[model samples]
Target: MGFNNWNSTHCRAEFNESMVKGIADTFVAQGLKDAGYTYVNIDDCWALPDRNASGDLVPDPARFPHGIKAVADYVHSKGLKFGLYSSAGTKTCDVQGFPGGLGHERQDAELWASWGVDYLKYDNCNNTGADAKQRYKAMGDALAAATRATGRPILYSICEWGSNQPWTWAQGVGNSWRTTGDISDNWSSMISIAHQNQSLAPYAGPGAWNDPDMLEVGNGGMTDTEYRTHFSLWSQMAAPLLIGSDLRTASPATLAILKNTEVIAVDQDPLGRQGTVVSDSGGLVVMSKPLADGGRSVTLTNETSSTRTVSTTVKDIGIGGASSYALKDLWSKATSTTTGAIGAPVPAHGTVMFRVTPGSPVPPPTGVNQLSDLPWTSAVGGWGPVERDRSNGEQAAGDGRPLTIGGVRYAKGLGTHAPSDIAYYLGGGCSALRVDVGVDDEAPNTGSVRFQIWRDGTLAADSGVRTAADPPVRLNADLKGATKLRLVVTDGGDGITYDHADWADARLACGSGPSAGTHELSDLAWESATNGWGPVEKDLSNAEQAAGDGTPLTINGTVYAKGLGTHAPSSVAYYLGGTCTSLTTRVGVDDEVTTKGSVDFQIWRDGTLAAESGTLTSADAAKALTADLTGALEVRLVVTDAGDGIDYDHADWAGPRLVCG
Candidate 1:
């Protein structure tokens, strides 16, 4: 089950001018010959309606004058493979209710094999999740059976819409699988698909590659930088490079980039280690794949809509031991050697691919071999920041007052279960971070424990925590600049002990942020909860009462101030109660707390100053302060902290309920 180097597609129909003269086939032949990209595929719209009354597959007599057989022969004549498309269920992706291959899979496979079809891209549009694996295996087995029946070795390509991890089973059934949706001719769409493929690299192998739908290289809209990133990531992910563009009109620059053998060699490396994202920041990502000849292929991609510099060292990709290496730029055909590491300039949505050939021999493996070696600690009581210097630490909350873990106790409770802080690779140039915490069976109370991260005192991400204890709590963050990371656990409604927390094992994906022409935080859920001053049912189940915005209502204790999102002290003032008699909540941005952009604070009762714009302060009780003076004041706290030159930092709403004299 050895995998081939490249599986290319020429999506001529992707253009407005559906049909091409001889140029479509000619361009494909050239790509297959020059670029070493096999499988000159004909995408949708190549066939006409069903010709036979029995509803058999047929080719468009006008588009394919010599019929499907002739096209296959032409492709074979160019020393390239020929592929076709079909549906496993009812309709194809193009909305045509094509005959399903599920019922007549064998028959259809036989017909295609007889017609000299070398590969098949079986799609899943109208397909349901009725035993996805079984259905896919059925088609794959049918294809094999057809090959045996017709004496042809037609390769099967499964396209199940990425419902499940097809790579886990697709290799047994087909040659490759689609891990993402269809590709469009835009930078955002291309980078997005590429990033998704990066995470599933370990599942990709020779006969089973992750298909990021197809390529949009020669297509319009995307720039040269974007195309480079697209090609670089696809190559590193070990994905099938199926081109979805008008090859005839492709610019010379595009031709050169695609034809670069050095870059393509990285893609075709026999070692077949799928690239993984190392780190990400400000729309930039660092990815690396092991090469066959004891080297690595690194790609620095800037998925931001604007150009940015993505600096990274080889050490960031678990290659710190490599003292010296030669970096061969795939796009520029330039070479540079360094003793330390290297950084490259990345255009907006662009990438820089390099062949990192180590100069030294292999070293013995040391330390934890697997990613799960790092220890994870659960938030003991109400999750929040705990001031623990080391193993000899104090504990907070419940019977587990002095919560012990491996002979260590975290005073200040298990610092809020921040998802963003859980998964981060410090000193690495990666973006998205995830942290997992194993919860104990001795469930006390459960409430939403929202995790908030501050980088250099700026809010990074406000992640939501799950109530269930089956799976450990998860905190994820996408830090954009501001190196130092901080976690803030707003509130855990109940008192459940988190046993272990896993951190720093994730990376940021490309194009994950809201694109241009769209409002930031527009998709965030906003609601109002007032006049229902209800007693709080604190537990992991109702964690939102402890965390802000997890639910509609804000829980106010008799004399305690509930935690909310971290905010800068200078720009914000939490006004509790009504306008006239409300308490003021203030934040001071300075030294430890660097603020950025706008800040939002809510009293929960009145929608006063939900978000304010201006330079923020990070000063503690020093300069930023506000008092709650309204009658029946509940809880007031800061929510959002934007980082566009504004400081954001250690924020908490303080209140002590009045005692009746």
Candidate 2:
């Protein structure tokens, strides 16, 4: 963990030698050094816009009157590391066009090392459209040579902005790679970057990280709750937590967030495992990072505008076989106990972090259940997140409609695109898995897919090839005594386009009977409803200001027939009677408005916000929204005008369903 000036000061006049020195001083005086934030890095504009007579970068005489080495020496005097920034191109990103290290990688590396620089935040601007890997690797090789020649180790950071999939090849090239564009001090920017970085967890570990840009904790654009979520997610992603705010003026709340030792420990854990998303339905997301000491750091993120009860199971986080677990809230410092279930009431745009330690060993759950109800060890979908109890709509999670194959809908199963792999921990308990597999009817006549069931390392069942014209084929896999179960779907000797696949009515017979199922929300009667333009329409989009003047619900080109559609500033309520366990749906601005509408979708359990869609426009694709309604008496679907005028704000709650007993 360290501090960088770009996000706060940027190329402003205050980014001078005295500011750098003051940062180092603040790090020592404010217990930041004790919290392990060492590096005091300066971003662009630290040097002159042009090179010197001998082709050497010259420090800006006005900004660093004493010289770059002097600032480095002062930082070292404080027992802190110093970092500098440059671009791989001919010029830095600033409008002043500062000279970069494009053809002078070796020269710049040696110069920075001579000045006692320990970290380099290489940028991506002015690259002249060269191959990303080649350009980045040139600097990587130069840094290695400089380290050997100068006998000084410098951490090389690749800032290519994921233009060329650097995570697949940046292992030895740099200590970290930027996985997304620069982040702003807002909830949408921070959370969207987190979402982009979370899927690449497998590419991150010790000595190599996925950089999602710098921290915006102390930035004034967002609330403290949102900043905590940002910090929690960054730590969980194993990202380099370079503080992006001005430390001299940082508030106590910001310092507390930056110095949370419990949270930092998860990032610095020797296991070096980046947290993986355990479940992300609606805006409630659960991430689990395996700790070095056999514990797990769990982050329950509420990305909506209201509070929610985000939850996950011990087995879901790759840990179980324990009767109980000790849960320590990393943020609140509260301790609790859980019998496999881990959850909390997280505030809107907040995260509840916990370090869970198993208390005693025990067997895993053995009840017969729908596979969608269980947690997968790993799930990679070709298009979007794997959907539960829906067809693979090839859009966002929960965007899929009911699990339909050959025009028949099944109430429970998994929805996946081609080239998907979902694995679950069976713990040698499941005796069999029965599922009807087929290419989803949504892609009928245009797609083909193959399905395979793997029991541990052995192939238990395989469907050669199934096309849309074919009916649902039942696959019974003998998973008796298997510790793991993997469901694989591949493109059927063709490209992946339109290859939506389904595992319909997937039931696993483990320790008991009675598998779970879901009911479509459109098929259920609503307790009450109101709309901005007209009555809420069932299984259709609100085309006109009338009850039945509607058409098939469509968002970003995908069509659905089973959902509620209404204008913005609308409310639709359903009575659950505390029987439903979850409600999953995809929400977006209905395509009836083309690209001219904006709206926000929210799920309210009783009176509290359970999930939210942030702000979505007609140009955006459908987004997943889920809520855990374990004991909810009533659930409400709400759509607002997104703080803008309500013109053309036709919102659709696409393919909403509730898992109830």
Candidate 3:
């Protein structure tokens, strides 16, 4: 996060005159302030080695030769705000040469105010286990008093990293509080921070926001796709948009991602509603945020490596009634209409962000079978304590549950020996439900655990019994008359012991009642991506994986798309269906790129040419590319060189895995 950039791309003493000037210029030149990225902050190591003779902090002359006031003035001239950083400890982090605001709270606040500092990122490091509330409150009060006297209202940000769980008491102490530690620029780090942020949803809003560190967009640590996911997650949760990279040297792709206006609107939404995880199955999670205009901001992310087909429905997002919403993809700006379900192929460590505008309501299809797009509702049965709070009435995880060795993440919440039920909001759409249930490694094997899914009051599905070593069991059963599902676990022939169970990858597949076109196939599986072999991508439309005409990519020969460059000869495979017979794809070189790469388009059915677009060049217009399924079990789209291998050739296969026959 980072205004200071932490240890990213810069060094401790790198905060200097040339650096601030360059950053200020970039802020204005890059339209950062105009795009709502208003604050330009310089973090730790900016101050002198120690306090001045008058007990006031000073910017290092060698670093900020003209002083911080000059820098603040320059930043102000850019029509943006200027921020500075310090700590609440005895000394700031890397204290060897930096001073902290231990006894200099008022002096520092007034100094910053006099210097026109509009923001303060007060950190907590090496502070020991001192009374955090009192320490932070002193800084907050000092800053407030400075504002009243100096006529400059500094936005106070508490970088406590949730050590004392600041969300519970930091409302009046800071404008935003760091809910997690410094975020490294990677998928796992981002996802882990996101998971913690999701649990703190109730603590975020306007003015008083939950800070998940800062943006790592231009850090070059993650792919642009993963960066999109990271950005979308932070915005959905109403976190502060602190730029942490060197904006002056940001790539065009990175800038495009950071300055996505539509997605930014979600973050700056006046309502300040924070989204939460509505569905998590097989590590594929869906986060839904309620926007101000009765619209919703939804992010579908894949945590597992390789590719995944992630799906969710309107009902899962808190929208009701059968309706087709105009789904606007924030990344690609592509819009589509779907009944209620949204099924798209998401690359590994990637995400699909959508701003769904409510469209015409209709009676959903009612005569086919498909997976339920609605999210599940969870409830725990019996016992509380240890992991549960009594006096505070808080939503604690295994807080008070007895004999609990440690907390385990279950369908409802984290706990073992749970008789918990995970109910799906099928909205009367699903006719059957299928789910895999298992006992996690946390199980102590103290007793047998019985897993069962009850449809209303009847037993719809059941996994007889399981021990610690047993893998997850699949429970497939009818759900037509079910009102709610109970994921009940019984302590077999013993008292409540270590009976940990999980409903892993639980799904409500359509069983005979969804209308035609209302349900898209959600049962398809995706293999991992291979560099030379390539991988099939899925989306309603993706400039990264689509022809310029906003159509599915045809992989016949070399072609050029927006994100993917011109290719050499390559082939990718996909599983259409058991009875698949025909394939339809919108294929051609994206009209945007000027490259005229030569490519041979051929579809191999069981290793033979099922269809061929003989020796094509980039001049050709986009058209329907089809391959006859005919007795073929495995199909591969072969993209080879027509003349030379591939130069600026990018071909995409969009839409679904394959349109079933």
Candidate 4:
């Protein structure tokens, strides 16, 4: 049903040759035949000299003494499968390296298949693009052809490392897709991989699965309990069980941990549903996946160093059965027909897997809805920035508008601002905060902005700016009930402005005042008498100056505006940027000072032009003429005159700075 490519890695020439020989020898010594680990996939650095003059993969003649064919025969003799590694791009990950597959896809695949290869782990290292799907498809086609050419049904393993969740398209290309980065041999590394795969279960099915790199079950830096948990979780998650430890010289404890058949059965269940987390305790978690005949497999893992009792009930498995179920401790062979579930003392970074059959009489959970489904409550008072709100005199949130919260200004510029530097001057008693931002496909440097969160002037979290839609970061802090929050945009610098910028949302956790989300931008007004170029005008009468209502102009329930320098020198100007469907610019007649100037109106959308206005010259007549900003959502108008002496009337807007649709 499923395959385990878990093996001990052998890199150097001597080690590689010896390890291959040892794997063949240990097959029976380790009692692997009785267990189900039949595939011993060699990771990187097993071949010699990389390739021949014709670009064919030439195994290191000495290391692969008899070549790959001999290795394959030896493995097959032990009734085990063999796998090889290569890159979708030209260079393989090995330090000595092989020819990158970029231009020679057909030749590489043909060579591997000719070597009697049973599996191919094609990784995506140097290749990237929206056209990545097509590139992977091309390689997949080559592999298929290679299979035909060599008359082998070689299993295709796409090792794009989950860059695009290849699971969505992996079946069409290969059997498994590594859904995370290369895993290290430690508890933290293993737990991290297990945690990240919880949401990817829906994409796994028969013949297709999420790969957590490889198994580190028997590797050092973890205890027997942790390794047990590692094996149990991989089995329950239906993950491709590729082991990455030294299998030949494994300790009795390590071999025993790797060959647990009970865990293997749960992994190889025909249903192929990936496990979902049922309960979590710090680093400990319980995950369950459905089995074929109304049964479920569960893994209880303690990612911490100390042993802890972790438990999960039947209802948490997403099943409301008819009064009973069978609980079988896969590792201990302890069977119990109970009403609810099992509680096991999991060792640090270790796990326990069990098979639960519905209608077998398990213990009933006493507290209904006890599984903490509260959707990760904003960590008490840790609400981050949010969309704008305009209730009291306030207009919109900070998504677009500029605010000097606590003294630090998180404006649209690429400069470093430490979270601890935010002053207490910001109106809201905001001790904690968040910024609502999304990645724009148009901004290449979006990755350039790094936001660092601080608590009481100490760094809490530092995030490299990312534009992905989900996983909006909500950094938390120990404010100690303090009444101030700070944000330091480490990369907002000169020459960078995101136009569709809007305050998506902000919030605050427990304190004497209202919660953080309560004091939104809707509570304040942006009534500047002067355009920061002069004092407040209180009354709107002069044509030389203009001020806004501090209140944000909202569209689609968000406050979108140009931050910093509301008034500019006409020809050279910038506006807050983001995704906008349209933009409009309108100026009041009383806001224009016409001596002799030309105004240029432009709107940027999707990082390209959606609209623009020809220079509107007002040399003589002019009080002002509104641009009627109806269609442009993110708009900017610059008025300037080439002749130095000719004074042109100022062109500006007063009612709403800019509205985004």
Candidate closest to the true structure, highest TM-score: 2
Error of 3 at 264 (Å): 1.1
RMSD of 3: 23.7
* Best model per lDDT: 2
**Tens-place lDDT digits, model 3, residues 537-571:** 33312233433323433444434232222243656
Off-target runs (Cα >4 Å) in candidate 2 are 363-661
lDDT of 4 by residue, 575-623 (tens): 2222122223343222233334444444332124444444544432222
lDDT of 2 by residue, 1-661 (tens): 8999999998999999999999999999999999989889999999887899999999999999999999999999999999999999999999999998899988988898899889999999998988788878898899899899989899988888998888878888999999999999999999999999997875677899999999998979999998999999999988999999999999999999999999999988997878878688999999888786667899999988888899988766656545678999999899999987888899999999999987745323543357887655556566665788887666544678888888788898999887777777677766777788999988858799999999977999999999989999998888778887889998897666688999988866564322257888998777678888888999999875667899899989999989998898999877664456899999998877865889999999755799999999989999998899885556889999999899899999999988987
Give stretches of model 4 more than 4 Å off: 1-10, 48-50, 128-131, 305-307, 360-661
In order of lDDT, best first, we have 2, 3, 4, 1
**In candidate 1, which residue ranges exceed 4 Å CA deviation?**
1-32, 51-55, 320-322, 362-661
- The positional error of residue 49 in candidate 3, measured at the CA in angstroms, is 1.5
Q: Give the TM-score of each candidate.
A: 0.53, 0.59, 0.56, 0.53
Clashes of each: 73, 3, 27, 93
Question: What are the lDDT scores of the predictions, listed in order?
Answer: 0.51, 0.86, 0.65, 0.52
TM-score, candidate 3, is: 0.56
lDDT for each residue of candidate 1 in 450-489, tens digit (9 for 90 to 100): 4565555567665455443434444555543423334444
Better of 2 and 4 by TM-score: 2
Say which prediction, candidate 2 or candidate 3, comes out ahead on lDDT.
Answer: 2
